[model samples]
Target: MGSLIFFTVSASAPMTVLAGGVVTTYAVTGSIGVPLSFPILGVALALFTVGYAAMTRYVENAGAFYAYIALGLSRAWGVAGSAVAIVAYNTIQIGLYGLFGWAFSGFAAAHWQADLPWWACALGVWAIVGLLGLFNVDLSAKVLGFFLIAEIIAVLLFDIGGFGHPAGGSVSTESLAPGSLFTSGVGGVFAFGIAAFVGFESAAVYSGEVKDPRRTVARATYVAVAITSVLYAVSAWALASASGKDGLAAGPADPFGMIGQWFGTGLSTAANVLFLTSVFAALLSFHMVVSRYTFAAGQEGVLPRFTAATWRRTGSPVAGSLLQSLAGVVTFAIFAMLGRDPLLELFTWLSYVAAVGVLVLMIGTSVSVLGYFARRDSVESVWQRIIAPGLAAIALIAITATVVVNADSILGAEKGSVLTYVLPGIVAAAVVIGLLWGYTIKLTRPSVYAGIGEGGARQAAALAGIEDLLAQDERIPA
Candidate 1:
């Protein structure tokens, strides 16, 4: 369970968020207290987890979102949610390659003077991730743990240094001031803050592999979210102070470059190296989560049986893992050919798309939480079942709306441009494909359709014709 939480927290990639994302927040929102959003989002997430944790006690599938949503809503909605999740997670995982490739190649050049194209570096990473995915997740978990510790140490050191030594002549608390957060472009701050939190929900996804799913998954979920929130909030606060006014002004344009200026070249170089490893950690964490989803989808008969095949010795989702790597390679190749800037074109666009997709998925999950408890009563309290999830759904819906209305600002795309629509369109397409596929199964294979998003006993009934028998018996009584 702790290892699973490590993967979940590592997936958030604190180094990347502090170095790149928070800077963007300052640039866009001019809201220095962008740090405050972390706790706010955390609380919202905690509300979400209330019902989510309760649901984990009942559902038993690696397809976390799909299974929960299916049990709560309907099979078709679960399939649709799964399709969107695959796209969202896949895009974000592949998008990180953009940063990793560019950073690694640049690192080699700066140190060893080994000049290489980004694609070459990316292909090397792809091979490594593909191989790791074949082994037990515990091995990769260890790797993440090492990287995660190093990452935490570095960020904390940076924060402590910033707070101890004033940036200019004096450190200012204006960034933490409440009024600062509501400034001009705060919407972008909220948007990116939510994106930074995308990975904290993964503990529930690893339930089957966890030793005591009931208590472990619930405990891990709470711990992961709490850790992530503090990490982001504290780091952002220190960064704003370390930067001073002059530095803050330039953040919108290049936070990475500005950090180098504040810390001198040596620390800057170290940050660059750490940034590459941070991205690598994020990539591996993403692979594990997505493979589990794919494994569940395939096992539930929504996808090919091949994807359900776990590794013989390790029980890892081998087929799904390799497929995710292959998809990443193809995505990298396409972007490299276009001559796009890895940070701007590759990272920004797809990440925004992913963040938006995640927001949509969470809304679905919140609804599922409410429905699950309402339709099927359990011993859980009403606050856990209804109140918390209701608040979460309302909050998530607002964020999604904000993103849609302010797409141009968050993404910096030209007003009414094709790029602006691309992120939202991918999610829509996934839903369309899922709906078509789900309905097709419904028409052609009613028995399999009965269990489209089910698992464990519910799925057994769907597969063994128990539902059909129950229906017949109901009619006979009349």
Candidate 2:
């Protein structure tokens, strides 16, 4: 069931919409080389997954970052990781809310002549998602699955049509050359690539709820990563080819707009619908991610206990879901009051912030993986422990650095560069707060500290057993 939720949410229509948005970003930044970047990033991320998957077998929890940190580092790190997860997923979710509202409002205004504000649509959708989240998890999964299938089919149709009618002469070899690869620079490609795999970690988070978590989680993680990579590679290639090398470089009015011209009105409408569905799906997926992180934190006593409460019958994290949904409502309300355009302003700004948070968390996870293996002195080969993690850390750091350097261009900032620093700064603050919290708990509650690695409920039980044994030993003293 957890795996189903992961797939439904991750592969939903919103992912496709996100894919289009990501592709557009790449095309603008990476140009004709955008297609190649996906594969390269995919391969590098898979390398990170090597140790990532290896670590999962040893630690299990619904909160992905929290669980990973607990196993490799400390409970403080786990708490901090959950904080980052909440910020990251919520940023993405809220950003998409802006995009969804803006897009749907435009759709309504143009198609139905309705003058309703974008926030009106955004709030309505938020209500629906919140209600759905309150119900059984399976229902959410089913809705996501339905949307995902339709979105995938529509995307495939666009791919076939684009490839069938190449915009330029047959596919060019120049797109594969080194010039194209470095045109956007390694930094640009890394940032864009990271977006594609942001949700891949959802697989690990579902371990507790999945049927055979050990196998299912690992398989799903790898499978989702592979499928997502291929889809990006193919769609990007087709999109670039459809626009032609020169045309692509020149930046057509709408790269995707050309699809409507080539495929005709029927297919164009289908593409738009798919894009909208993709946005919705992304919103749902991120919501699930944020709620689970909150639930995990509560379970571990890192957050308010109320968030840990689950619906007994459904075994769903009801309080956590409502909390996250409430956050979404607040965010929407703020943007609405500011009278900001959801698609152009809110979506662009918050999504970039979320991306930065995720990258920071990834860096932390990579370091923890290396540390865990180093301490264990496990017989696993050096590459898994040393090389892969080392390389991944370097790559992630480099990507983070590049984002910092090009923060203006990436964030679409005017003269002010302050917004560019906000993301990394936010992540750093979270980590520092986590470290402090961890120290406090360690000094005041040694028992909880000892059980941090074991996780919440299990850790408490283990501590009780230890106390019982000690009491018996004292009683029997002679």
Candidate 3:
């Protein structure tokens, strides 16, 4: 459970959230109320978890949302959910390369006088992450745990510095006021704020790998959300108090520059190094997510069977990890060749798409929870079965709507620009294609279609054959 939380929260990238996300959101949206969004999102997600955790006792799979939606609603919707998930998680994973590259490049130039391009730095980290993905998940968890601990320490010290030295020598709670979040820019706050919690739902993505899925998934998820909410809220409030209401609009573009002013040059330099590690940890974590989703899709026949291949000794998804690495390489090359700004264009655009995509999945999963419990006889209470998810679905609907309406602000495009439509259209297009492919399978390959979200049980023969091949090629463990 501790390892799972480490994997997911590292994906949230605490240092990146403080230095990049929180300050940027405040600057972009001009909202001093950014501190309040974390707790608000936490409440919504807690309500969401009531039904989500209940479903985990029954359905255990790597593709958590995809499996639940398929079983509860229809296999067609599950297929569609898988497709959107692939795109969403891929974008979030690959998008971090841009931020990682830019941060690393700046750090190298500053300290070592080594001028490296962002793409080069990004590819180097990509190579490392790709290699790590093929090892046992526990290995990856250990790596994430180390980085996450350092990140937490760095954030806490920075928060202390901010609070210890207020902008006007007195801490202010103006940003924490509930009324501050009700302004015209609230949509931007929710959109950007939710992006900071990107990896919280990923606890269930590791359901099959854990020792105790029932308790681990539920407890890890709730704890991750609570810790993230408090961390983000307090750090954000401290940041605001440091900047003061008047200085927030004009805060430095590089947030650490402000941190340097508060905590001195030594800590700022250390924080910058940790910031790079934070983004790398997030890349690895999200890479694990995308690969597992692809693995689950293959196990269920949503993708080609080769994707289900795993290394016997490590139990790692061999083919899915390679496939995601290939996707990352191709994406990095395209952005590098086109000369896009890593932070502004690559990170901002794709991260927002990921945020929106995950929100869509949550809403679907919440409704699916209700539908799932409705069809079966179970010991779950009425509150768990109906009321909780029902209200969660409603809350998510409103939040997603608000996110969509303020899409222009989040993406930094002019109002009514095609980029807004195009970015989100990626998910929409995935849904349409997924639905069509799912229906075609239902008609033409009914046997395969019947096991669309059943995970490994229905794919035993295919997995055995792959294992035989692996053994022959490399003397893999039986």
Candidate 4:
């Protein structure tokens, strides 16, 4: 179960998002340094993960932020963390909806010469995912696994061709130089690279479903990060090398297109097919993420209790999944009604908003890691406890600031600065609301609030102990 969730979290949606759009943006922004930036960001994130994984051993909860914040700080902080998560996941899922619709429509037009609207494609997928979410998690996992295999094969083929047929003559070391990396400014590279690793930490969110929460979560976290980092580094390097120094600088309209040219028309067609498959995987993964978060928040009493209720047999959040699907449907309808192009207009617009939200959430998580381990008496190193988190916080904050300052360029905005300010502002508002909600809970229901970080059974045990009751109800019934 843990492995399945980890697969869903890291492999599915991210492959498409990173390959289709983010990689091109990274090449443009970071130049040859794009390959190097990924590992560096991975290391920084790994530092935070050390403490994050360690804390998981002590506090087991489906709500990752809820566990971290409650263990490290107060319930108020946990609630705020949860809110950031909700916003981040929701934004990402919705943004992908727009992208999926656009990609599907484009493929249909290219292959079948069909002029079906993008939203039509989006709505169809939305309905399918919603129906699937209401059933078994295993079914969703199977679908994702199939998509993952296809995407990996596609990426590998592209990478092989990249090295096999060198484009623009030969590769250059200048693209990997420190100057080129820092030249485009570290902020942009950091933001783009961080986006590549969005789903890495999601392994913990499946603690409830996993076989061994303690070992599985830790192993999955490290393995997922390691695998993803290696893949990104190799693929990015291959892309940069394939494109060559001049091509890298020239900024081709389609980086993947250049790869196709080197590999021949057949491979290019395969890549396009893979690209669509990648988007489908990403959509499935994002749907799982948002639904789980909704489930976690609801269980914590931050939202309605119904959202917490799971399908007894499948162990899926039926209500939360339905809610997320409904939101996607509504957003699809709105964009279609406005006569917006799903890819160019809606997906591009909302993806930036989601990116910003994720940045804020990552920064918060890094900080929470630092705070959680600050005064520890364990054998943990100071680097993991203080230095790494502190450095990551600084880096993340600087990246966030840069994105805010240059939202126009970062988001590919054509006009109106309102979206630039509005998106970040919305994330801020969500955090504030979460904080207030936490405080309200503290005043009204201190017991439930105090039980935040402790696992469900542990909390029930503590409550039962306080009442001098038996342990029968504390254990999950056989």
The segments of candidate 4 whose C-alpha lies over 4 angstroms from its true place after superposition are 1-14, 23-33, 139-150, 164-167, 172-174, 178-189, 205-223, 240-267, 311-315, 374-379, 414-416, 458-478
Please identify which of the two predictions, 1 or 4, would achieve the higher lDDT against the true structure: 1
Given candidate 4, what's the lDDT at residue 50? 62
Ranking 3 against 4 by TM-score, winner: 3
lDDT for model 3, on a 0 to 1 scale? 0.82
lDDT tens readout by residue for model 4, 56-117: 55556634665677667777877887787777777677877787786778778867899978
Query: Which numbered prediction scores highest in lDDT against the true structure?
Result: 3
- Candidate 2 lDDT by residue in tens digits, 221-326: 6666667778776776677666676666564224335557777767666666667777776777677767777776666666666887788778778998898898
TM-score of 2: 0.83
Candidate 3, residues 139-178, lDDT tens digits: the string is 3556667777888998998788889978898999889888
How much lDDT does each candidate structure score? 0.76, 0.67, 0.82, 0.67
The TM-scores of all predictions, comma-separated, are 0.86, 0.83, 0.90, 0.82
Measured by TM-score, the strongest candidate is: 3
- Where does candidate 4 have its weakest 10-residue lDDT segment? 469-478
